[model samples]
Target chain A: MKYCENCRVSVRTGRETCPLCQAPLKGESEHLFPEIKSVYNQFILFFKILLTATISGAIASVAINLMLPESGLWCHYVVLGVICFWILLITAIRRRTSIPRGIVNQVFWICVFSGIWDALTAWHSWSIDFVIPCTCMIAILALGVLGKVLHLPPSDYLGCILADAVFGIVPLIFYLTGVSQFVYLSLSCVAVSIIALVTIFTFHGKQIRSDLARRFHV
Target chain B: MNQIRTKWNKLDNAAKLFPTASTRAETHVFRFSCELTEPIEPERLQAALDETARCFPTFGYVLRRGVFWYYLEESRLHPEVMPEQRPLCARLYRPRAKTLLYAVSYYGCTINLEVYHVLTDGTGAMHFLRTLVMKYLARAYDIPEENLGYETAHTSMADDSFRRYSHRAPIKRTERPNAYQLRGAKLSESRTGLIRGTMSSRALLDAAHEKKVTLTAYLSACIIAAIGEDMPLRARKKPVVLDIPVNLRNYFASDSVRNFFTPIYVSYDFSRRDGTLDDILAVVTETFARELDRDKLAEHFCAFLALEENPIARITPLHLKDIVMRTVYHNTIKGYSATLSNIGIVRMPAAFAPYIRSFHVCNATNKLQACVCSFGDRLSISVTSCFTDTAVQRRLFRRLRELDSDLVIETNLLDDDA
Candidate 1:
């Protein structure tokens, strides 16, 4: 073991440089063990670079917009867009372990972002009438097909499918509140959600109920 | 092929609290590591693990919560041996993620075995680690396997001693005021900071002999004194209690690998007397003398068994039980300031002794804990704390350094200045 005088800590792995201060370590003691390298270090470096690029882009755009008056607060949108991109990307990365869950999450977020963007751009109803219902229908179909084809144990994807189905049924609220004038997509979404829920309850009812209980366990 | 029926066993009394009390921060996981003279060969170690896993059948089971209680069911999942990349004693038994209750990993020359406390205690884990090391050395050096001389019977290793000894009358429980608590900013993500000191066992033993006390008693006194030095005067109104886990295998004639131990607390209040190491040792020595009896220990466990035997506790759903258990656990932890578990000396067959360096045991805790064990002339005292401050560790080690001037310290803290 070598003690790093600069950092005032002992280094058991005998590294050439202090892990904290990056200064060359001084003084030696009995070597107890070898140094271990973590796998997360590379991912951390990648995230650092990504953060620097995003921050630099935002800062530069703000400076450029301030210099040019005609841009008219577009930099705020740019900054928000970058933040949303990172949020969506990080969620996708975290849920990447489960394909069914990952797809469901992506579909949910895409629907949400689309609705927000549509409402901001003068509410043409494209989000609720088309984007949300279309996305929900595709998610329901994908989840329904993948649940079987993936050969996953029921405990693995049942909660995810049930959650997506519950989200899918939200379109019925739009129909009930008369917010959605075009009823074709909304009705289809409701129909698909109901069919999916019924199938899950019929074929894998016990497993789904037990899975929900485990997930909701406090 | 004939279909075989798998058997499940109920967790012992002491293990009942772990499944419900465990959280992301305190998973009740402890690790035992054996450092060899050279780097480990993964394939050879894996082969040894396969054989050792068969020897300790109860250790390979997964934990499952039943409608009324948590039980262990035999798992067919092959233990996956990997490299030690995670932090020390990271959460091992997360729900649905690799169902094995224990994990085996190696980093450089150290073979690390991290076991969930629900599976076994330090005594049981030590047996498994020793057997694994012996088998690995035997295979690597072409030594005879039988020379290891270990009992491989499944019954002997899986016997529930707690059940066998719980036939006594239950004692009434008494409530005591909370002990003095150690407060500090914890490390990020509940990571435990480890600071281990390596010293000569002969030197430490000689010092303990000079004090006319056992090494454990001496260390316990030192720990109490160290805590007393830093505790505020107002905080000293409550006693500073040290929770020491006693291995019942020494008193009982059982070879069970499941959890079978009880904690005996030794508390000392600074306000009541002038703080001195000798005064602290007298209290600890007297506490051990009174509480170390067979009947007294058994009665302590019987009270625990009485709780499990209550009809309402038995019939409640596991989720509801979890809420109650968590509350009980929070209050239970508040009763102690710190925990000190002395695993004592680790002995091995002579043939494999030269290949191993030392053995270390550390438990995950939100409070400060010190695990003391010895091998040959090397006495390894590992201090694991969730707090970022090393004040307690510094005082303890500096006190020991007065005896052995050549004490070597190894720590995982990012900086050494504290």
Candidate 2:
């Protein structure tokens, strides 16, 4: 035990000075608490570089557009595209712990951003016709395959599949509103969603019901 | 295959605030560690943890978010005993994570049990650590198993005692000026700094008896004086308040291993009263006398329950409730400068006493917190702070050293490179 003459208390550590008084101590040392290394996130520098590159690219694009009068105010597309990239990247990173949750969140953001992108580029209706329905269908199928392959308990992936199925049915609204020009993918998306819902309700009825009750309980 | 219905529980009255108010800095996680006479064996410790986890099923539950409040849902995740890797009292409950709310880790001769506040309080955590230690020692030494005197029934151990004892009472609110706040540079990465002082319990008890005050009261006065000495002249206008959490299981007839404690504030102003330990002890004793009454404590907790029971507050969505509760918790915490929690004496079977050295308890806090626990003649006062300064801890230990020169201090902080 090391005794600090200044604080007059014996310390049970390997340090040379007292923790309280910071004065020199006398005698041998004993280790009580283990030394923990500080956690340093290596991705911080990579993220910082990416952030700086994106901001500077956006600024330089805007500056070039300003210098060239015939460029026709196109810098906004670059700015919004950078913002959209970050939104998707952040959502993916935040939900990386749970694959099911990440897939569900990615589906939602991709559909929304794709639609916004299409609208900004003179509304080709491709986002609603192809992106929304195809994305939803793929998400539902991937969730089912991954849930089975990963052997995740129904409680973990059931809610995510149900969410993706619900999103699949959203294309029906686009079909009814006539926002979707081609009807095959939208109808197929709706059919897939209905079939998935039927399968879930037929087999995992009690599990989904209890999950809903728990999430929605007041 | 038939799916079995999982058990779920509502957050006890005191636990409701932790989910929303806890942050990376103050994780609302506390640790109770038992140091043994010999080095810990990993395989034996893991076996013991498995047995203990089976005994206390509530420890296996995971925190899940609901629309109205966060609830504990039974999960199949098993807690594995690993070597201590993270900092003391690291974050345990992530919002949507499916992991258990408690962890068991061992280092050298000590076995540590870190618990999220939402799962249980200090008293409950102590019971768990004791059981784990007892089980490990029994396996290592070939000792026979024995009962540890805690309720073994799963239903009773998981009961929410706050709802059981709450009565309809008129809520009382007393407005006062803000208490003194500790201002300084906090440690980086929101890490907690722990300095524990282990001394003979008999010496401190005799000192308290000579002054005709309880051990908790004497310690509170010592802490208040330590803070008072560091107070600037202008800061003296604000009283140094110590928030002491009283364990309710002592007054109520329940065996719940969940949270069931209420804090009562003891404020002492140096500008108004003579800044001496005697005067501070007298004030603290009087405050304890008035606040520790059975009826008053009941009424205080009932008032707390009243807010939860309000019709409007019950219907509000959880996102809104989280914001409001976070604000309310911040406002409420402003009324106290520090926290002092004494889990009282920890007892074990006589057969297992020879293998144990001492028990220590501490919590992660944004402000200074002192957790006291005693086993046999050895009493440990663990002081945890997020700030970088140690003046208050220095004074407190110096005062404690006056009582017994055999004080032994241990810290998790490394020496500064000067």
C-alpha lDDT values of all predictions: 0.82, 0.91
Alpha-carbon error at A79 in model 1, in Å?
Answer: 26
TM-score of 1: 0.72
Off by over 4 Å in 1: A3-25, A29-218, B1-4, B96-98, B146-150, B416-418
DockQ, computed on Cα atoms, for candidate 2: 0.63
True contacts kept of each: 0.08, 0.63
Query: What digit string (tens of lDDT, one per residue) describes model 1 on residues A105-217?
Result: 89888898888878777899889999999988898788777867866656556667788888989999999999998999999999988888998898778766755554333
**Candidate 2 local lDDT, B1-418, one digit each (tens):** 5354667888899999999999989999999999999999999999999999999889888898888889889888889998999988889987777889999998999999999999999878888998999999999999998999988898899889989998897656768679999999888788899999999999999999999999999999999999999799999999999999999998898899999999999999999999999999999999999999888889999998988888888889999999999999899989999999999999999999999999999999999999999999999999999988888999999999999999999998878621
lDDT string for model 2 (A83-137, tens) is 9999999989988878999999999999999989999999999999999999999
Which pairs of residues collide in model 2? none
For each candidate, report its DockQ versus the true two-chain complex. 0.09, 0.63
Q: How many clashing pairs per prediction, in order?
A: 4, 0
- Badly placed stretches (over 4 Å) of model 2 are B170-174
Candidate 1 lDDT, B248-291, residue by residue in tens: 98888777888989999998999997789988988988998999
Best by DockQ: 2
